[model samples]
Target: MENTVDQNGLDEAIIVALGCNLSGAYTSREALLEAALEAFSSEGLAVVARSSWWTSAAWPDPAGPAYLNGVAVVQTSLDPAGTLAALHRIEARFGRARGELNASRTLDLDLIAHGRRVISDVVMAPHPRAHERLFVMGPLAEIAPDWRHPVSGETAAYLATAASIGRDARP
Candidate 1:
């Protein structure tokens, strides 16, 4: 998916997935998530549509705190890399720390896609692993059921049903 998208005439939708298992500074996971959504606008990202928070048991360790997850359709002027960087910044503001793989964190913001663009350069658009996780696809489907995968052209609803990971995910 290493390709360039023209930033000049960009009119495609931007999609992002949000997840969190720990509340960090916030008193509740939902509050942390809500604050993150607000931060998006501060960073110049406009959230056009958002899915309701979904819940799932911690993967590989169901005994851990359950996760709250959702997806957002955003409109931004920045390119894929810039968009990813903004997401990271927003995550960091919520105390997200990049450590072990899939470690529980305060915030997890993933750039699922930048319209139909397939970028594999500084950032990966149409996030490489999103399709495999129901936690990601399910919420995405809830908001945009007919959205097509940039590469496979599969509808978000179909992908959500076909996802193998996070089978316990629910809204």
Candidate 2:
């Protein structure tokens, strides 16, 4: 679908994606990030805040190069599932191959939070793993430090700190 913004401003939401490998033909990390952002914006999502890409060692599997991760706060009318499906389509367009749970790929877009809405079917709410992943929490805390998890009731900043401590304790 062609990217277009509606006349009335839509509600805001935050989306996060990690650029781990240009597993496809694309070679630059910036290009991947731009494309992902454009895909979302094209769907009438307005980006409010963005975070700098953080380079991190691979997780779950370590064969691929370190990942470049960032987050974007967007305004959109689409429901949680709709927004997520849009992100999935964008990833597919960039040649993201989905298989194993934590395999590396060119694009990985996650619906971090959706305006306090908690959804559990097919698409999990508040991203079940958001608090535990440094790559996600770091950027999220940067943009919404005071934001509270709809379910856990913990502040983003707290979760981020916990994630950092968890990482340090790991081998």
Candidate 3:
């Protein structure tokens, strides 16, 4: 994660979700997480809050291995594109190689939300799938329990609980 200061020096905060399932993906699960944190520090991004790593059954394919998930709030001066780029860089640093959608991978970093931006394309704030993912909600609630969806206004904890039940029902 590389940081680029804005000309105005204004800081923008963003929520990020992290996950990993492959063993040899990046040395170890713990090390992969550490590498992420180290990248945040290296980029000079301020860590507002962070949740502990969570282990959950792989979605759509429980037979695969469980995934270690986490969420964090960070303050950066970079814009949405810059922030997204930094996240990709961090994932690449951990040996992540994107393949089939939802397929097991080394490391996964998602730009869950950035302020109140409702963007599309590769950088969608208030991620379209975030409210329905317990893995994201569980960790997010830890750091921002009262957080409401910018679009739906639903609470984080509520979404997390709903996801826990809905996850099993999904085809």
Q: What lDDT does the true structure give each of the candidates?
A: 0.87, 0.69, 0.74
Locate the minimum summed-lDDT window of 10 residues in model 1. Answer: 1-10
> Each model's RMSD to truth, in Å?
5.6, 5.6, 6.0
Error of 3 at 44 (Å): 4.4
| Candidate 1: tens digits of C-alpha lDDT, residues 1-171 | 112222332337688999999999899999999999989998889887888899999987888899999988888898888899999999988899899987999999999999899988889888999999999999988877878889999988999999998999999
Ranking by TM-score: 1, 3, 2
Off by over 4 Å in 1: 1-11
Flag the better candidate by TM-score, 1 or 3. 1
Poorest 10 consecutive residues by lDDT, candidate 3? 2-11
- lDDT for position 57 in model 3: 80
Candidate 3 structure, TM-score to reference: 0.84
TM-score of 1: 0.92
Question: C-alpha displacement of 108 in model 1, angstroms?
Answer: 0.4
The most accurate candidate by TM-score is 1
Question: How many residue pairs clash in all the candidates, one count each?
Answer: 0, 1, 0
